[model samples]
Target: MFCSGCGQALAAGQPVCPQCGRPVAAPPPPAVPNLAFEVANYANRVRALSTVWFIYGGLSLALGIVGLAFANSFLNGGGFWMHGPWAHGNFPFGPGFGSAIIHFAWVMVVLRSGLALVAGWGLMERAPWGRVVAIVAAFLSILKIPLGTALAIWTLVTLLGYRNTSLYDQL
Candidate 1:
């Protein structure tokens, strides 16, 4: 007989389920898969992928912060020797050119990190808007190649290709 608690096969006269330790009186309602089970399974997979987005967003934020710190230090320490002619103020844009580039990098980093965090949150909550944000983010992620491509594919499949439309609507 199958255990009611865990659905593991139970030998005759067994008092409790070995997998779940729950008492089993009869076979599970049926060995058949039901809609509830399928929905739960799909939701779990989506949540798992959402966790990946959170980690990616955090790393992006950290990397950006580090870049900002490095830029600030470099500017204050007068460590511009690597700029060649620009180091000697020979460039047409003057010495402020490096600062402008660093600022632009900081802006891009902030935008990327913010979007990632929002997308992660939305995916975890199964929000409809979050799905849209995640789709856009995934498309952008594809441009990153390799790892990003894999993540984007997984995210797209979990959110867009999921079989149950009702589950997301309820969430």
Candidate 2:
């Protein structure tokens, strides 16, 4: 190292310059942090969130299937139609209106489930677009109430919280 005051070459760990009597300033310590631990924590959280998303997606898919089955039964002269006045084609909304509504509802359910599944897959695979897809899914799931709301909040916090941008970039 070179002395700052005298510009003379100095031996390592020498406190003072021999010729100039100038004290050598110690270099400042590096600002090191426990990055490995923090990264591990973030990784675990992401894995857990991905698992939750998979579960939520599976449940939503099942629910959609059940709803579609019910709708099919209703339209095929079963379920509510077996006892309701609508059995005689006396529906107030006119023919096929209820069917259209049911179709729309089931389609929405399927779409939402598909999005959740895709988000979970992306996260689990650590894809380049995973974070963005997961954020979008979390926002969409926020209004689902109870389990979905909790998952959404957790996901948002874990993925978007302080220092998470760097952590995700490392991933």
- lDDT string for model 2 (93-170, tens) is 887766787778888998899999999998888786988899999999899899889989988988886588789777
* Worst-scoring 10-residue span by lDDT in model 1: 82-91
Where does model 1 exceed 4 Å of error? 1-31, 71-83, 88-92, 162-167
lDDT of 1: 0.79
Write the residue-wise lDDT of candidate 1 on 15-55 in tens digits.
Answer: 89999999979544767887787778878887888899898
Task: Score every model by TM-score.
Answer: 0.70, 0.72
Give candidates' CA RMSD values in order.
9.4, 6.7
Off by over 4 Å in 2: 1-33, 79-81
List lDDT for all candidates, in order: 0.79, 0.85
Error of 1 at 48 (Å): 0.6
